[model samples]
Target: MKLRFWGVRGSFAMCGREVLRYGGNTTSIELVAASGTRLLIDLGTGATELAKLLMQGEFGRGQGELPILLSHTHLDHIQGLPFFTPFFVKGNRIRIVGADPPGLSLQATLQNQLAPHYSPLNGLENLAAGVSIDTIVPGSTFTLGEFEVETALVPHGNMWTTAFRVTADGKVVTFLSDVEYPEPEAPLPEALHLARHADLLIHDAMHSDDDYQLRRGWGHSPARAAISVAEKAAVRRLALFHHSPDATDAMIDETVWRARAETKIELFAAAEGSYLEV
Candidate 1:
């Protein structure tokens, strides 16, 4: 499996000279299995660029299917769907997997994002016709090409967000962003399950200890907390994700060092455009 970060910022997108190194887009990542099967984790603003890149190749040519696993319908996570170039093409197909939200269905949640008042595109009906959506059941395991995927629930941002663990190319990788450690003393049981023995654990590091002290329930963990989860999960590599909009390259770099000084885990700040071969 090959993993790449298209966006790493959390909460919202930020721009400035200070963030140039890490990037300014929200949270979206791509994983390609050994059989060339592609899976998109989120549809953040970075997906615009990814769409453009895909169009330049086979995906744009409407040659294959796209499977998207959305964590939750946060604005920063779903805002890019309106701009995804693939939506405009007729022959393209997108299979979306999301956990149904309260009151509205998963499809309706995304449809509302593109509703009349907010977007001129109006609705998903105007986009590709070959789209299918399904809600994921917690703890369910399924196969997509050569990858084995597992989904679980986690508390985040006043809602239950989905966490994913994927096994491919003989490696296990977990992605659990926008997660909140409400207890402040222990980690999520699902986090432990998904990240256990993982080659890469892409967990949220959107805050620091002090930040968590100030914003305790903001659906994110500090760098230290994320490091602790990696240690407890026994993951081989910890990729710190969902960087705070306010975090700079230097701050993230410092946090990386802080995590490294405390443990022997392979830790790195997930930067946009950076690729990890697993």
Candidate 2:
């Protein structure tokens, strides 16, 4: 299995000279199995670009059925759905897997975002690659092609989000995204237990320790907290992701430096186009 980061910024997009090194797109990643099966994780603003890239080559043929695994319904996570070019293409289909959000139907949640009010692209009734949504419960395990996927519940922005553990070709990679660690310094029994002993753990490191106190309960963890989680989980490698939009290249470099100095785990900041073979 191979994992790639197409977008790693958190909350929103960032541009200009300050953010060039760490990139500016929000949370979207791809996991491709050895069997040539593709699993796209999260469809944030980066999904629009990914849609364009997917359409450029022979990728839209059979077995290109995209399975999108959504962590939650946060704006930064679902904002690009309406603009995904594949939806407008004929004979293509995308299956969206999301948590069964409280009170809101899956179809209603998608339609509300894609409908007239949110963006210019409206009325997806006629688009191809038309969405097929399925609500997934936590603790449920499913198979997508030759890979085994499992989900666990996590705290996120006053709502519940999912942490996914994917196993393919004898390798396990876990994605613990948009996770909020509680205060005053609560134990991470649940998260550590779920992510325990994975090959690679890609985590939400949207804040620095200095910013964590002010942003507590904001559905994101600081770089230090993310490192603690990875260390406790005993994962072989930790890839820090979901960078803050305001974080400059130099700031992120410092964060990664500090994180590495403090933890024994191999660490790297998640950047767009980064590839890791599992």
Candidate 3:
């Protein structure tokens, strides 16, 4: 299986010189298995670019059917749906999987994004991607092509979010977005179990210790908090993701260095276009 990152920023897309090193695209990743199955994670601003990439490769081929698994309905994660090019093209099948929170259903969550209050994509017919929505129950296990996925609930404000543990080609890859690690409690059981012994663990590290303290309950993890979770989970590799909008590339680099300095686990700052083979 090959894991490719299209966007890695958190909350919103970062731009200008301050974030050039880390990139400006928001959360979106593509996981391609040996059997040619494609799994898209998140539909952030980055998804627009990934959709373009997919279109470029679509010449002389049939419509591409891709599974888009969303962690939640946060604007930063699902805002790209309206801009995703494939959705405007007929025959392009996109399967959207997400959980519904108290205020909305899975379908309604997406509808809210496209409603008049947001944009002109107020109707499903306005989209050409031929989308199919599926609601996934958190804590349940499912299969997509040859990949086996286990979903678990995580603590997020108001809206419910999920952490995914995916197993494919004998490799385990876990993705945890917008997760908070409560302080003073050595290991966060939910995060640890999701990432435990995985070949690659992509986690949210949207703040530093100080920032985290100031933004408590915002549902984001500090860099050190993520590292501690990785350490306790015994993960082989950890990629810190969902960078805070204020966190520059340099700061992210520093955070990566600090994590490496503090632990033996291989640590990397998730970047756009980064690819990992497992």
> How much does candidate 1 score in TM-score?
0.96
Error of 1 at 186 (Å): 0.9
lDDT of the candidates, in the order given: 0.84, 0.82, 0.83
Q: Residue 259 error for model 3, in Å?
A: 1.1
lDDT (Cα, 0-100) at 247 in candidate 2: 93
Candidate 3 Cα outliers beyond 4 Å, as residue runs: 59-62
Model 2 residue 207 CA deviation (Å) reads 0.8
TM-score of each: 0.96, 0.94, 0.95
Superposition-based RMSD of candidate 2 using all C-alpha atoms, in angstroms: 1.7
Error of 1 at 185 (Å): 4.1
lDDT of 2 by residue, 112-190 (tens): 7777877666755755656788888877899877768888888887888888988888888888889887742353677
Q: Give the Å error, residue 35, model 3.
A: 2.4
Put the candidates in lDDT order, highest first.
1, 3, 2
Q: In candidate 1, what are the lDDT values of residues 58-140, reduced to their tens digit?
A: 66777757888888898898888888887777677788887887566988888888899999878878776356887888689
RMSD of 3: 1.6
Off by over 4 Å in 1: none
Output the TM-score of candidate 3: 0.95
